[model samples]
Target chain A: MTFFINSVYFGMVLTFVAYEIGLFCKKKIRLAIVNPVVIASLIVGAVLVLGKIDYETYSESVQYITYFLTPATVCLAIPLYRQIHLLKKYPLAIMGGVFSGVLTAMVSIYFIALIFGLTHEQYITLLPKSITTAIGMGISEKMGGIVTLTVVAISVTGITGTLSAEFMLKLFRIKNPVAKGLAIGTCSHALGTTKAMEMGEVEGAMSSLAIVLTGILTVIGVSIFANFIG
Target chain B: MKYLKQLAIVLIVSLLAELMAYLIPLPVAASVYGLVLMLIGLITHIIPLRLVEDVGDFLVENMGIMFVPPTVGIIACVDELKQMWIPLLVAGIFTTFLIMIITGLVTQALIKKTGGES
Candidate 1:
């Protein structure tokens, strides 16, 4: 029993270490898709399951860190604050990019689900997968989703964005920070925003703005469409 | 005086936004409307940044603490999640990856067209 508690500590330590290693790999590997957070989280999650370390215990242990999501998100306003002038300069362009990006994410999921014949519950979960965890989970609840599934989906999407975004952008010949930021937030929400921040301020700011907007639009979009579907 | 006023405004604004969700014929709830309205206020200086400023820093510094109740919620779902494991897992993984690829593609194209700026 004692070993189990200690193992949870090791699990966390490994997660951070793996994340740092992923960061280092960026230079040597020259690959954008293999992000540190993704690699670390996956490695850690797998280890916990394999070790039979009890997910509940581990989560309880790290519950403190997860709570930081609110402040971390609110701090987004700091970056947005810096780029207020930039928004004024190209309101139309930014709005076009972000709204389109948000719609694309939501529609893509809905269409695919329709083709696959997903249940109403699954569709609800899909609705908020593109937004940040807090907002996504909140929306999922309103729409009658399984919050755990939504959270897991959200975390996975976020980690994927953090790890793969840069390389994907480059591979596809993407260079606009605003576009990059919008894509990141629209697809992955808060976790992706962290990586966006590392890229530069404009990317960070645009990503933050996208997070807030994506949540609003997605909620509105889902509710309206779900109404018609019913 | 300050916190009370801020709380009042948040409550009122959030309520109005919630009302809008019904009027606008959308699937989303009122908090979302409140969020958008709040952002607009901040953007236009209709609401001062000062109001949400301290709230943010405090929240960030304490993020890890907020995830407890939810994490516990996930734990309690062990049996239920297992029952629907296949679909949930498949949907979670499939949709996340799909959204990432397509959105990245579309945005990359848009950026190229927009001259990759602004």
Candidate 2:
């Protein structure tokens, strides 16, 4: 048992198995809330807690997997490229929608944090919650927020967007696929983009484009917003 | 060989983006620079889409699994989360709804104003 746990592959194998199970559950359940990442995190997290294995050991091996995050994020460009034509047709509408969404996310989180009397660190952690994990993690770390909390916040935001996106779009009577895609992607990042994809081709493409643009916008926006709290 | 070449293109672009991040004095993440660089490269046909498309699709498709490790780190901060979960949950849900409606309506209105085909 000691030897197996100590092996470099322990964490990696555990993560893969848990993720596979999560994938299975997602397929079987077919619910927005049945997020594979959340399920896998719970499974792996439970193993660490129950086995009394320290986070250090788990993360050391897991670093191998995380190395792909950067390259994957860079590759987001491919989808954005494929969908670039949508930007041309409704450049003003798309850009306007994304910009306003980004602004609202930052501003709303700021006030909510203040209203709740959250600590400075907690506030900053939630600041980038609406962006994709790949970019949001870096922003959180740079701004002296708890990176783990930011990750959780981001996942929750994505899930919330995914679950509510359809209902909210209908409630607001927003029929434009472009508007729907941009809203979900901007507010919830990639996870919500998954829902956007399912909505239709136009929604999916616009949402993919929104993910890249929202990430870029948040990267630039966080620095300015961080000052409000400071 | 095909996959390796596609991956190599992505890696090189990522490396260049990292270098740019270090040198550029902006507070931006390396991933953003990498994304912008790749977008420009593709638009200009300097780095053809086929060079990176296959690997890119694979990575994006499987990106969710990669986050498992970092998210599991939540174990380390259970105390902070416990203390803040209510506020965190409130802010996350409320703001998500707010942003969605605002962005959606704004875009819809703008599309109508522009007389663009929706």
Best by DockQ: 2
Which tens-of-lDDT digit does each residue in A47-66 have in candidate 1?
66676666677676665455
Native-referenced Cα lDDT, model 1: 0.63
DockQ of 1: 0.20
lDDT of 2 at A196: 81
Task: Please give the RMSD of candidate 2 to the true structure.
Answer: 2.6
lDDT against the true structure, per candidate, is 0.63, 0.85
Model 1 bad stretches (over 4 Å): A1-30, A228-230, B1-118
**Candidate 1 CAPRI grade:** incorrect
Candidate 1 chain B lDDT trough over 10 residues, lowest sum: B60-69
Encode model 1's per-residue lDDT on B59-88: one tens digit a residue: 433332233234333444667566555555
Model 1: residue A37 alpha-carbon error in angstroms? 1.5
Off by over 4 Å in 2: A119-121, A134-138, A141-148, A194-201, A227-230
Clashes per candidate (backbone, < 3 Å)? 24, 0
